[model samples]
Target: MPRLNAVLETALYVADMPRARAFFEEALGLSPFTADHRFTAYTVGPSVLLLFLEGETTETVILPGQMGTIPPHDGSGRVHMAFAIDAADLAGWEQTLDAHGTSIEGRTHWPKGGESLYFRDPDGHLLELATPGVWPNY
Candidate 1:
């Protein structure tokens, strides 16, 4: 018997689609993978990050249905998305984000190794970029 390896994709609701796209592209360096009237997608290494415009339309509230092999979401509060990068790339990433005027909330360092920086999107959702070897064994 054969089994399928699980993969993950993330979707986020943005109030301003254009701004969100610019931030993800310029600040995070994620290349545009696809786009449409309702949504835009960026290629994040092996995964894809999707952003959908959500607001009080004249009609009804739009809730995203499961669209990927693994849909990432949190039912309550503002959801968070985390990007993992090689430890060596951490400094460069930080500089790039700074140049793009990304506000840094703070960073956490692990005693064993690695660290992560927290920030927010234009919509006030939490986002993080973490270096590899960060989380110690559970």
Candidate 2:
């Protein structure tokens, strides 16, 4: 049997491409590794964050010359995703978010000596920034 590696990608569907792109790039400071009319991808540490235009991924994608086929997939409504942060940098993150005019929707103090800051993306996805101790393996 083969072992699996960490999650490589996370995707969210957005109605507005430019708004969503600006929020992640300007607000969150994520740089896109690739982008096009249909989707944009950003490098989040070792993983990739993908933002696909709503209703665009309904059909399978063919790689120009039979290189490969990507099956269709998309999402709707609000969803949740979290990012890991250093314990010491939590305050900086808060200030950055504030400077970006993003409201902190909620926060949590975990029993294991961790903290979390929750907010929403431009597309209404519930995003979380959590400290190391929030989970057993984090």
Q: Write the per-residue lDDT of candidate 2 for residues 29-114, one digit (tens) a residue.
A: 99998999999999989999999999999999989886999998988999999999999999999999999999999999999999
lDDT computed for candidate 1: 0.75
TM-scores, in order shown? Answer: 0.75, 0.97
Highest TM-score model number: 2
Clashing residue pairs in candidate 1 (N, C-alpha, C atoms within 3 angstroms): none
Q: What is the lDDT of residue 31 in candidate 1?
A: 78
lDDT of 2 at 127: 98
Local distance difference test scores for all models: 0.75, 0.94
Instruction: Return the TM-score for candidate 1, rounded to 2 decimals.
Output: 0.75
